[model samples]
Target chain A: MVPSPVMLKPALDAIGKAIDQRFDKLLAVPDDSRARLYEAMRHAVIGGGKRMRPLLVVAACDLFHVERDRALRVALAIECIHCYSLIHDDLPCMDDDDMRRGKPTVHKAFDEATAVLAGDCLHDIAFEILADPATHEDPFARLELVTELAVQSGPAGMAGGQMMDLVAGDVTYDLAGITRLQQLKTGALIQWCLEAGAIMGRASEGQRKALRAYARDLGLAFQIADDLLDVEGTSAKTGKAVQKDAAAGKATFVSLLGLERARAQANALIDQAIGHLSGHGPEADLLRAIARFAVERDN
Target chain B: MVPSPVMLKPALDAIGKAIDQRFDKLLAVPDDSRARLYEAMRHAVIGGGKRMRPLLVVAACDLFHVERDRALRVALAIECIHCYSLIHDDLPCMDDDDMRRGKPTVHKAFDEATAVLAGDCLHDIAFEILADPATHEDPFARLELVTELAVQSGPAGMAGGQMMDLVAGDVTYDLAGITRLQQLKTGALIQWCLEAGAIMGRASEGQRKALRAYARDLGLAFQIADDLLDVEGTSAKTGKAVQKDAAAGKATFVSLLGLERARAQANALIDQAIGHLSGHGPEADLLRAIARFAVERDN
Candidate 1:
């Protein structure tokens, strides 16, 4: 049975609060000049976004009954990577975004230099959190988390995807090229979130494979939803510029596939994503709900 | 007797070659649009700088007789951190420098967006290398390396120091303030190098304490030398802009202590740095030579 997307709301709100509190505790402002750096980081990370990635992590961990605190730690690490990337991407050199999450972007709020350093500090903190003994009882698990996050976010992953996006205006990409780009840019970290859960829980090989398959389809569906939002979402709702890919002449899922076809494709991907979890029962309801939310979310 | 600083040259050259080769192998360009990003990273990392940090890591590991391969992996990781820091620092919003290590800065060689992503990619690569099992037979050791590097390079360390440096024009830093800033900025990573070696070797606490003391003094002396160079060296000799600190009215060791007093203090610190290594014989000679070279080198 398909779960109601409304059920995903409670989990999303709970994860959002947990993540905000964790960042607040971790980024206490120092009474020094460096306070500005911390503030910039806090400003960028403390209150923003859909918390989608962290939610994905927590939901995956639920499948294995991983400790909430342990899962939260991994969630925070991935969120930091996400926040840092957003901060850098919004810089005048990249996206030139002024607003994020309905507030001034880091560079817009605290100058370009501070934004750069803040993004960098957040990047360092992600690894520091993953490497902490508190994150996992076994050192091997902690190491695995660190390695997966690093590989998924570095070149050939998120950063590599961003590079492709940066040159998208000049290089004409067909559907295959766009799919590859999204897989690296947005899909890689999303994939890491599920793998992290499996690592922490020490899930069996078959279980891990099931989660991997779920993540892959969910990631693609998530990107398709994002492309759809870019075309249809209001700036007020999105909290940042919309229609940017189209304006830049960059080929996106929506740009290549007409509006009706793109909506159909997103729904199809979500259905496929949900199908990947056929082996699990009611325990996987949150994951199923999230897959629906990926396509249904307005922002 | 103090070894001649000249003895440090052979080790420096060898580590430089090894690091360059490793980066070359690690960053083979993709046959896609992301090739620009890889080129920017290779440009920033390959065939550049004195590689002081990597050399320190290798030398410290030598004290414990850790496998040369293991030490090199750790060294490459640290070097990546250092290189990424340089690339970011040279950004237009940061130090705004054009040349680094006698070549165009990454942002100058590539576009600003590519430079930003390249620096981030290198930052990711650093943790990936440390978290790899090949870096250490023990997962605990790999986790320790990742933790130490992240802590030393994050908010309370390198990035924090950079924030203070950025605000130096507005903040009136006295001797203590300047010292604290430098300690966090430069001293932290140098301290990490020594600790990494100790961790890999599983050194006695007393030995770790000694290296800590040595690193503290050497890092300060290195900064003092840098300040001295800023005041007295030519841009051509330094491969970067010179005397910008004085022009900006920022207080550095040389500016606060006067040239003669600063030079004398550096020499004294070097003497103290070498004194911390007195417990060991010729195996410690390279470290001793490095301590002397820290204050004596032109760049």
Candidate 2:
């Protein structure tokens, strides 16, 4: 069943706060010369947007009875990947965006040189987190986490997706091609979040299967919603400039399917995403709410 | 025993040829639109370097009789990290060098955008290599490798070192401070290369301790020699610019210690590095040779 509106909000807020605290704790680099880098990393990740990834990891871990501490570490790791991508994507060579979350991009707040190094460190630490025994007691489990996270976030995953996005203008891709692009670019890491809980909990094969399917549909829906926001989200609400995709003449789900059709598609995906969690009870309610929110959120 | 000049040349040649083949084989990216990114990654790593890191990995693995194929793969992975670092270091925001290995840097050869992505993928794939079951049958070993490599390469490792290098001009560091900087910047990964063999062989604790000590000294010797090159060697042989240190007013070993003392320091470290390997037999002869070459090479 869907979580009560009031119930999910508090949970979401709590997770966000927890992520902020833990990230601060992790990023407290020594007061040596390298402190500037740690400062940039902290600046990039702290006080950010909706902590959807952490929320997913937390809710999923709740399903498996995994320890909160272990799951939070994985949450931190996955978020680092997300944060790093954002930092790099905003580089002068990449998106050239000046602002994110209503604040200066890392390059602007610091400098281009610092921004690049900050992004690199964030990426580096994500793998370190997964590989650490703190994430899991079983070495095999830790290895799986490391390899899967590496592959999912590497060339085969987000990096490859980013390549496709960068070259999107150079080549024409059909809707299917675009879907594959978004699926890997954003979908890959989203799926990783869905698996984070299961990985921490070592959930049954059936549970893992259902959540994987849930994450895929939800991941696509998240992108569709993002595309919708690009077309329709106000800079005030989204904390980013709107309608850039259309301005760039890039094809997105909304562009391909039209506004009405894109909305319909996203709603369908939300339903499917919710269906996958049917086997779980109240423990998975927040995930259900998260799926709905993925489509419904203004941001 | 220090490997004779004659004995070392053949072994070095063999390792270089093997690395070339293996790198070529691993980098055959699919012939798709994303091939450009792969092409850039291939271009950055394909032809370059003395392959010292690979040699270190191979010699270390040889100490334990690890399979050649496995050792080569580890060598490939570590070299990926090294190559990625060079690519990023050449970025306009970083060192901004136009050439490497006497050819156009990746950003110049391609574009800054492609160079960034290419470097990112190379770093990504290095982790992928270590995480692969093919790297090692023991999952625990793979985890150790992944964690150690990630730790050594991340903010605390190479990335941190790069940050420090970027900020070197801003901070006034004496010899101890400079030593700490170089130790993290280049020393960490070099140490990782030494540990790679022990990780593969699952060598005894004593063996790990000795090799690590050997690696620490050798790594410092290698950097000191690099400083010496910046002072004494010409770009013609180094395949890159020289005298960059003094020109930038950087505080390198040579700058802090002067040429004669720097040479003396490197020699002493080389001796210490060699002494650490006293327990190994003929199989370690190549390691002994490589240690000397680390400090003695013109490049």
Candidate 3:
């Protein structure tokens, strides 16, 4: 059963605080010229966003009773990828975003060069954290994490997705084209979050398959919801510009399917996602709530 | 003793072809919208600059008789990092150079957004290559390679060094400051190339130490030679802008020490680097030759 927002709030709050504290510790500014790079990274990452990705990681890990600390480290690595993408996407050359998460973007705050390095540095740190023995006692597991993260976030994944988005205005994308784009851009990483937990927990193949199925549907639901937010969300509520896809004439789910169908599709996907977790019991409630929250979130 | 230029030439050519061929295969363009991103990556990486870092990885691996295929994979990974840095560094928001390796920079050939994504994609691919089982049969060795590469190329290493370089014009750096800056920026990855070989070969502690010492001196000498090239060589020879440091009024080894002193210092470092390999016999010739080549090459 899907839990209410009130029930899900605690998990989200905990993950947010955990991620913030970890980043604060990880990005302690050095007393050197590189301080600006660190500060720019911190500014872009700290005290921002809904922490949805980390929340998914933590909730997935909880399913197999994985250690919280281990889960948090993996969560941080994934968040680093997510945060780096946001910083790069917000660059003037990309989306030219001025504000992100209700504050001046990294380039606006620390110049273009620093923003670029900050994003690059974050990308490096993601692998560094995963490869460290502290992240996982098993080298095989660490290698798996590194390999998966790289594949999902690299050319065949998120970057490729962004490439499609960049050319979206020039190219007319049908539903299938947009679906492929979103799967690579957003679905890949979200899917990795679930797979990462399974990897860490050493889940059975059947369990892994179920999680993959759940992740696939949930990722689409998440993107459809994001498209909806772009159409209907407020900058104040979303903490960034809204209606950008429409303004740019990009083909998104909402743009293609119309608002009513898009909203219904998102809800249907969330239900399908929750249905994939039928084998799990109370432990999977957080996942169900998160799937619900995917469409419900304003940002 | 250092081998002759003719002796090194064959090895250089082999590595260059190998790296180019590997990149060509790895980046086979997708039959989709993402083709531009892959094309930009190929444009930046294939048939490009001196494969110095890859040579080092192969040479060091030669010391312990690591498989040629394994050594080449590590070499490719290091080259990816090097190429990605060049692409990002040439961005308009960064160093803003139009040329790299005598060709239009990635950002010049492709648009700015594609360049950024290409660089990022290459960065991700580097770790992906290292973590793959094909790179190493042993997970421990693969993890070690990933950890070292990440640490050396991340915030405290290459990226940090680049950050200092971005602020070089603003800061009046003394000789010591420039040394530290160069160590992080160029030295880190160069050092990683050697260490990667050691990890892959499972070299003993003593062997690793000797290689580290050799790498340290060689990396500095290489940077010093680069500074000398910038001051003395033309864009036609170096395949990049010449006298950029001087034009920007940024302090470099050549700018601080003048031509004669800088050239003398580079020779001395190369000698020191070669001395570190004294314990090895002719198996070390390629490394010794690389040291000599570091200070002697015009570009």
- Give the number of the best model, judged by DockQ: 1
- The stretch of ten residues in a row with the least summed lDDT in candidate 3 chain A is A1-10
User: What DockQ does every candidate get?
Assistant: 0.94, 0.75, 0.92
Cα lDDT of model 3 by residue, A1-299, tens digit? 46876678888888999999999999999999999899999998899998889999989999999999999999999999999999999999999999999999999998999999999999999999999988889999999999999999999999999999998978899999999999999999999999999998998999999999999999999999999989888999988988888888889999899999999999999989999999999999999999999988878
Candidate 1 local Cα displacement, residue A64, angstroms: 0.9
| Stretches > 4 Å off in candidate 3 | none
Q: Cα deviation in Å at residue A194, candidate 2?
A: 1.4
Task: Give the per-residue lDDT of model 3 (tens digit) for B1-299.
Answer: 46875678899999999999999999999999999999999999999899999999999999999999999999999999999999999999999999999999999999999999999999999999999999999999999999898899998899999999999878889999999999999999999998998898899899899899999898898999999889889889899999888889999998899899999999999889889998899999999888888887877
The most accurate candidate by lDDT is 3
What share of the reference contacts is kept in model 2? 0.73
* Candidate 1 vs 2: which has more lDDT: 1
Per residue, candidate 1 scores C-alpha lDDT tens digits across A132-215 of 988899999999999999999999799999999999988999999999999999999999999998998899999899888888
For model 3 chain B, the run of ten residues with the poorest summed lDDT: B1-10
At residue A54, what lDDT does model 1 achieve?
94
Poorest stretch of ten by lDDT in candidate 1 chain B = B133-142
Worst 10 residues of 1 chain A by lDDT: A266-275
